[model samples]
Target: MDSAFFSMIFRMKYITRWGLMRSSYPETLSEHSMDTAVLAHALACIGASRLDKPVDPMKAAVFALFHDAGEIITGDMPTPIKYHDPQITEAYKRIEAEANRTLFSMLPDDLKPYYEPVFHPAKEDEAYWQYVKAADKLSALIKCIEEEKSGNSEFKDAKAQLLSMLSSFDLPEVQVFMQEFLPAFSKTLDEQSRE
Candidate 1:
């Protein structure tokens, strides 16, 4: 039997919502995935410690890392297309679900269980999911911070929308992270710009 790890090495093509350097960020799904994974783990750990929630931080991180694995085959559909409208959004979600099912099928039987939870997460892990969603938004917010630092107004609307999404989440730890740390990213962005 072939080892399953080789299946994951296929180079994916993604259309980034963030534009190329001239106007926007040139983010890729792979880079975004890594950031989300780290943020997910940190937020989950912080939430568990602060809120007494029994969340598996590692699992959450893993989940976030692979959450968009389906995009490898389906490609990254921007939020504008994925959520153009209620009907369009629901249809795109169904497409994503179908794509994930297809991706799960490519894995060996032994690896399926290991990946299914990430490909089609359970509702029981809602809190963990929340953290991942928050991480996604935070990642975009960080991107906007960088973009704005580069004197790009393209991400200004994105920054506002991301902050709005961040504020909508009820997690105290996440809120605290936003409150205490997010603003500093701008300074960091500015300092890094000259580097």
Candidate 2:
């Protein structure tokens, strides 16, 4: 039987993020996932190479790609409402978990074992998950930066909030990326090319 998995995953392009705010350029879930995956790979590399930590860059990238897969079913619940209180946060987590399970069920039985960890990360991969989380926040931070650079103040507060959240992460890899690469997001193409 043909699996609907890939087809359902492709619908990520139709799910726009930052739905509550006006954006100069709307970002799709696919775009966000790609951005997160790239960032996750970089962070993992930084950890393994520069920080001398054991991190599988490929795994991080793959995990990041599927990190928000459930959002397709949840319709991108706005963060404010999703995390307004402990009860709502707990409820949303349950809903998200169910959504992920539904997505997982779409895969062929033979492939289920391989994709299991992608949907529900193993406990041993906690360190890698931290990197994914940091990368996810970095993606949002980049989005906020882009929005502000586009003269949209709607994301200004979000940018600050993301900055604070990222700063709280003790991962030196995150700090390295923030310091070395993130600044380029604020520059013009010409300015970046000259540097």
Candidate 3:
């Protein structure tokens, strides 16, 4: 009879990120998810309105919001470990799938349907998923930019690698986001405040 499942998910803030690097500002899974959701929504909107691709921004946002929910169960695996090689990446994907299932099991039977789509969408929503992926990378790029701004040398190579990876996406929405939105992340507080 205990159906307070979401409260567990809400503790995503407890899952800290950048475990390997010294973060000037600590980031949590909750914060990353929120940024990913907002960026996904924005990218979806830009695609629909500007790039001639129609997508449901709200759906994309919701998908992004739950994209990292599996991290709550698996903990935040560092990217290097998660993608160290094809075998490791495939193994981690399986682990993540199980973790996602474990997360869904917490929901009450009646509410399972409501969250299932958010956790695992249908094939038709591939474009939405792609937008979420782009948003995730964009969020990471922003994090790298923030680290560089804090004068941390740790993220220097990460920023360059992220930029290279991002450019490979070749999605117009991703391109537009990089060109029109990403540059501002490099700005100073004074410059942002003035604008």
Candidate 4:
């Protein structure tokens, strides 16, 4: 049977993020996913090469790519509403799981096993998952930085919150990325080129 899996994946471009706030430059899920994947790869590489951790950069990057695949089906739920209450958060998690299952089922049966670990990560890859989570937060923080740089004060609170959340991770690789790479996001293209 033919699969609609790739077609569904392409629909990621249609899902806009930061639904509750005004954005200086609107972002699509596809863009966010790509950013997250890049960050995840960097963080994992930092962990493995610099920190002597056994993280797989490629695996983390691939996982990060699909971290929010469920959001395509559920639509982008505003963060405030998604976490307003404990029960609501739990309910949303269930809904996201169901959405992932539905998306996974779109794959051809022979390919399902290969993609299963991405949709439902194995326990052994829990450490790598942490990297993906950090990457996800970093992506959001980058968005906030860009908005603020564009003179959009709407994301100020979010920038602070994301920074705090990332700080709490206490991962050396994350700290390194924040220190070494994040500041560049606020620089002008000319300034970056001059450096």
On lDDT, the candidate that comes out on top is 4
Task: Name the weakest run of 10 consecutive residues (lDDT summed) in model 2.
Answer: 74-83
- Backbone clash pairs for candidate 3 read none
Task: lDDT for model 2, please.
Answer: 0.93
Query: What ranking emerges by lDDT with the best candidate at the front?
Result: 4, 2, 3, 1
- How would you encode candidate 3's per-residue C-alpha lDDT over 1-195 as one tens digit per residue? 885468878989999988988889999999999999999999999988998786889999999999989898888989987788999999888999888888888888888888888766788988889999999999999999999998988988888988999899968888888998788899998998898
Candidate 3: stretches off by over 4 Å: none
Backbone Cα, N, C clashes tallied per candidate: 0, 0, 0, 0
Compared with the true structure, all predictions reach lDDT values of 0.77, 0.93, 0.89, 0.95
Kindly report which residue stretches of model 2 are placed more than 4 angstroms away from their true locations once superposed. none
Q: TM-score of the candidate numbered 4? A: 0.98
TM-score of each: 0.87, 0.98, 0.96, 0.98
Better of 3 and 4 by lDDT: 4
User: Once all C-alphas are superposed, what RMSD does model 4 give against the true structure?
Assistant: 0.7
Worst 10 residues of 4 by lDDT: 112-121
Worst 10 residues of 1 by lDDT: 12-21
Backbone clash total for model 4 is 0
Residues 68-173 of candidate 1: C-alpha lDDT, one tens digit per residue: 7767766777666667789988887888888778777777898888877887788887777888888988887888888898888877887898888888888887
